[model samples]
Target: MRFISRTSSDGVTEQLFILGEIPGVLWTPEDAAGARPLILMGHGGGQHKKAPGIVARARRFVTEGGFAVVAVDAPNHGDRPKTEEFAEVVARLRAGMAAGEDVAPHLATMHTFLAGHAVPEWQAVLTAVQELDVVGAGPVGYFGMSMGCGLGVPFVAAEPRVRAAVLGLLGVDGLAEAAARVTVPVRFLLQWDDDKVPRAQGLALFDALGSADKTLHANPGDHGEIPEFETGSSLRFFARHLG
Candidate 1:
């Protein structure tokens, strides 16, 4: 159920897999011949890896930010088929959010699903980046958006290799909870008018962080249209800290 394609440019060939098992385009660079910092990408609820915003963001990471980007598809999303495991989690989270009950439990389930799936997908990616380390690219980073706030936060906190973090459209509890645990430098790009998650959530996340160096960048757009390259400042944050 997976379709894969290889695209090359300037001696760098990236294997783009339309993963049937997970339902997202897993892009892993080939012949990198060295270790490189990795960026694991995530999408919002009910959305796919092919969303224009997410795809464009990945492109920006590669072309401009000069990092390896693994754009992931969560369960029941994108080209991947839906399953009871996924549906149950989604429903539980939705219900929890609606009832104003604690959603931390459902978030745990979603994180487990993502981390488990990252094994095979991350394999192709690490292959390319590992060799590049001879020259320099150090530990990896997690840059996620929307639900990515949930998935990325847990993954980085559990994995000590994560040296930099970026999040967009983060929920209040998830962001605040993860921010407290993140020992690395973190940046949050928040939309002041985001109807889905609200701006206060991002502000709360920035404020909750125990890290000495954390940033919260607010813009005029809502959840939908973030200024392209909104991550320019984020990359700088990583450079100052992760470099």
Candidate 2:
């Protein structure tokens, strides 16, 4: 990983870096040293690694939990160029949404395509990030919702480095098999009124997790309307598992 630039503010330091083809950012306490737990965050669809929500959560994790956090731009998003195959899939997805078709299948296709590449990319990023002195080979956690959860389920399932995860806003369409393999502690968040993913499907996904230690947090809201208190809850979850 090659760092491009770094800036510090509010007792946190942000570093932008390029890991091969992946563009990512890392957040840590200012002047931090030695090995500390790391949290890898995956942004929702159509969002970049530095999206406002990801940054806010990263900062809070660094300041409150004293953890290092990293987020990477998924393929075809942010600074990465879209492959022709990915573009075609996205075009179909947009067309389906425009025609008011049920987008679950389209979203499933998109997530499948993205996860094929994202899982290995996350593995590589984890390997590289952990080599840094400021972020060592300590326990790791993952945080992703919606598209992030779609991609993260498979990645976390395949990666043994991850000790815990905050995942939800996705259903069991194309991810049930992977969900069944994730043995890490999981805090699954579901929106009771989510129109994007049905409540039954969300509950089914939660049911599919193989972890003996899993909790479901359901609130009345749309897909993007997760309650703010959940963020604090996630911090405590990671602190409890990773520390």
Candidate 3:
């Protein structure tokens, strides 16, 4: 891993780095040391590693939970060059959406393609991040929603280092098998009236999880309207399982 820059503010430190072909950011408490629990955050579709939500949550996790948080741009996202095949898939999705068609299938296809690359990318990032002195090998947790959840289900299932996860805002279409493979503690958030992801599909995804210790937190809102209090609940959930 090669660090590109480092900045500090408000008791938190942010470091940007390049690992192989991936560009990512890591956040931790300023002057942090020793092994601390690490949280890997995944941003929604079309969003980059340092999206407003990802940065806010990463800083909060670093300052409040005393944990190291990391985020990376998915393939064909942010600083990465887009592939022709990926562009074709996205065009189909956009056309489907504009036609007011059932875009779930298109979304599933996209997630499947992305997960093929993202899962291994996340595993490699985790391996590299844990090698750092300030963020040693330790219990890890994942926090992702929407497209993040779609991609995360496979990563959490395939990676043994992840001890817990906060996932939701996605459906069970192309992810049920992976969801069934995840046995770690999970806190799945569902938006009661999500326009992008149907309520029933979201509930189905939660039900498909194989974890014996999993909780579903549902609230009345759209896809982007998750209640703010859920963030506090997520911190507590990670504390319970990852600490």
Candidate 4:
């Protein structure tokens, strides 16, 4: 891993890092020393590691919650180059939609392909970050929604280091099996009137989680209209489990 640049303010230090093909940002409180709990954040599809929401959450975790935060771009998103599989999937989805054909299957296939690559990349980043003394080591947690949830479920399932998660805003198709494997405590968020994900599917996904300790926070809104108060709730959730 390599540090490209770092900026500090208000007691928080945000640094840009590159781990081979993966580019990420790490946020930590300047005064923090030794090992501290880490929260791995994932951004929604079409958003990069530096998306406003991701940055805000990272800052909140580091400064207010006293935890280190990291976020990396998912495959075919942000600074990563687009893959042939992703291009083909998008083309097929567009053609299918134009032809008045059901594109649900295409969407599922794309999600699976993305998640397959994303899980390992996340693992690689985790491994690389652990070697950096600045991050130290403690408990780890994850927070993401929508595409983040779709990929995060599998990543969390495969990674034992993660002890808690905040996931939601996704359908159950490609995620149910992985969700069944996640044994960590999770707080799943849902937008009750999501236009893309059906209510039944969202509920089913939450039910699939293997964790005995899981909570669902469903609010009235569309996919992008997540209530702001939920952010505070998630910060508390991470603090309780990972602090």
Point to the candidate with the largest TM-score.
3
Instruction: Estimate TM-scores for all models.
Output: 0.74, 0.98, 0.99, 0.95
Report the C-alpha lDDT of model 1 over 1-243, residue by residue, as the tens digit. Answer: 244776766533455554335544533344554545567676776777767766666665565555666665665667677778878777888998899875555665665675566544544443444444422447677777767776666666666666778876766563456567877778877888876665666677668766676777788877876776566766666556655
lDDT of 3 by residue, 7-82 (tens): 9999999999999999999999999989999999999999999999899888888888898999999888888999
Candidate 4 off by > 4 Å: 96-104
Candidate 3 ranges beyond 4 A from true positions: none
lDDT of 1: 0.64
lDDT of 4: 0.88
Model 4 worst lDDT run, 10 consecutive residues? 100-109
TM-score, candidate 3, is: 0.99
Model 4, span 120-171: residue lDDT tens: 9998888887776767667899998988898899999999999999999987
List per-prediction Cα lDDT, in the order shown: 0.64, 0.96, 0.94, 0.88
In angstroms, the error of model 4 at 202 is 0.6
The 10-residue segment of model 3 with minimum total lDDT is 56-65
Q: How far is each candidate from the true structure, as Cα RMSD in Å?
A: 4.6, 0.8, 0.6, 1.5
lDDT ranking, high to low: 2, 3, 4, 1
* Candidate 4, position 97, lDDT: 76
